[model samples]
Target: MGGEGENMTEDAKDPVTYEFRDGAAWITLADAEHGNALNEVGAAALWRAIQRARADRAPVVVLSAEGRFFSVGGDLASFAAADDVSAYIDDLADALHRIVSELMRLDAVVISVVRGTAAGAGFPLAAAADLVLAARSARFTLGYTKVGLTVDGGTSLLSATLGLHHALHLALLNPVLSAEEAHRAGLVAQVHDDDELDAAVDRVVAQLVTGSHAAQVTVKRLLRGAATPAPETALRREALAIREAAARPDGQEGVRAFLEKRTPVFPGDR
Candidate 1:
């Protein structure tokens, strides 16, 4: 479709790749030399691309990586090079936390398509997504504790997403789970063959775009914040969203289309 869409390259070291196609944006870790490791340059590049995606009005975002490794996580060499090692680590940690939190805050739905190994911060990157599609060849684990490092980048929030006991197990045990096992444990939503991973991600993006933009954003906000908000606050948030939806033209069209037995023509739709 549309000649496979445009693949825009960003100029930055360490290979942080991102592309915008149709209504979806894809960001893949391109640092194959280091097993797509998350170095300071790579992390900063990703953060910048994400901001670009937000500004571009993309309806959906997908995260993946080139090579056999999705990401091996942090770059120890970079940390070792810093003059103030502890301060550098703290700053890096803060950046990662902001990145993770922003993934949920972005209006569009974000999905992670994992193939091969996704460990440490990489695992949490997938977890922070609105949805995750993993290839049968994929593996997930928490590699932080094994490396004598505490988890960061909203690892606690990822644990909350996967539930307390399982989250604790991932952190403490650090055992790798195959894509099938991940799906079974509710960590991944869909699993496909290695050859079919790209198509599967496209299918998800297509399904995501079927909903009106407003509805998608509203649902994303609700789901992202619901578990963290107070009961009364959550209810109020939902009610406010409902009121906004009812006021949108698509909302009225949806109701009228249901009554008239015809499809609703949403605004900004081609």
Candidate 2:
């Protein structure tokens, strides 16, 4: 495993921080104050970090976050404050989708380490990774509907990964799945004790870095090709749906209520 070095990017000050170590790239969501939510700036920074990781051609990329939460999803406070909600969502989706695309297309293996909660767009972020390692206490949810928003971050891929019925169940019910449940549903590749997570992740990365990089890359590409609906197509649909939902009255109310720490009274709630 690679030790952290001082080769941090200039944009390391952003909510998303990037560090290159040995043969791996470590991308951490550092905005713990807000549950590591992705605002427009964070989204853009993450996209750029992903691009840098690909350019570095690291054999392994580890995505993790500071604080208890992996991420609570997009920053709804930012969304509620935007003058043009639709445009705001479109921009967010654009950056996030690019990040997802890069993760899928990169020759290196992408790993997501989930600790606390992964919700909304966060769910897709974890699901997009080639391997997801979750702490025993970690939880997952597709929380889009709670905020009257639709899915983004290439969640359409979930249909293929979790099957149509299970995917729809998640999308509609928004139940939080524990690490064990997530692994059973194929969302997480492995679960580790909270205390052992870092070591477990390091072990996996060590194995990858020590193995045949070319063979790993070839296998990844082959498996991705075998998946249906094409990542590009799924991303496009997700972007459009998110934009449309953000423009709805219910979406607006939901975001506002969330930021205000109140129950959302969506249209027809009365």
Candidate 3:
């Protein structure tokens, strides 16, 4: 673990708090007073935090929020207040899209810890993570239509992951899924009791930190590649990545530890 403090920003009112510790970067949505709704400043600050995590070479990145609801999605009040709603949304979407792109391409394993309701863009943001862990009380819904908006933050990716039929049901109806239902629907990977959520996340982070960073990163890349439409290209990339991983010190150490029947201490772990 590392020191705990709010991320420094010129604007003290920024709604995101970022911290890097051990081999993980923790990004918390700090605007709980407003249900963590993202306004222009919050969106930009979130992107900056993601960029910082990428640059820091963290092996794992945890995305969580400070309030009961993970996020209510885009700040509707901000949008309403904007003189030109169209332009406001356009810029907000651009910033959020950049953050989504970074998360998709990042080598670090991304995890979303959801405790309460994740709606609209928030739902897609959680879906974008490599893995999602939700408290038993967590709820999720694609709430765009309810607000007279379409979707953003890579909702299409969620549709692809969930398959068209289920995706349509979620998008068109905006029905909330409980944590168990989300897991059944393939949206969340694990569900923990509300009281156990923090420990569960910590356990996962500890496990990831002990593994070979190079191999884990390569695996993430390979999985992303496999998810794309280009199978042949994805296979080729996977082959190259595996070979590259095998040449790295952590990979070599992993193999050696397995052969010796000893616990592996990856470079990042040290």
User: Which candidate would rank higher by lDDT, 1 or 3?
Assistant: 3
Q: Could you tell me the lDDT of residue 206 within candidate 2?
A: 94
In model 1, pairs of residues that clash are: none
User: In order, what is each prediction's RMSD in angstroms?
Assistant: 18.5, 2.3, 18.0
lDDT of each: 0.72, 0.87, 0.76
Candidates in order, TM-scores: namely: 0.80, 0.94, 0.80
The numbered model that scores best in TM-score is: 2
The local lDDT score (0 to 100) that residue 164 gets in candidate 3 is 81
Candidate 3, 171-264: lDDT as tens digits: 7798999999999988899999999999999999999989998998898788777664442333333334433444455545554554466766
Model 1 TM-score on a 0 to 1 scale = 0.80
Off by over 4 Å in 3: 1-6, 9-13, 229-270
Candidate 1, residues 50-81, lDDT tens digits: the string is 88778777789888888889887766666556
Ranked candidates, highest lDDT first? 2, 3, 1
For lDDT, the strongest prediction is: 2
Better of 2 and 3 by lDDT: 2
Ranking by TM-score: 2, 3, 1
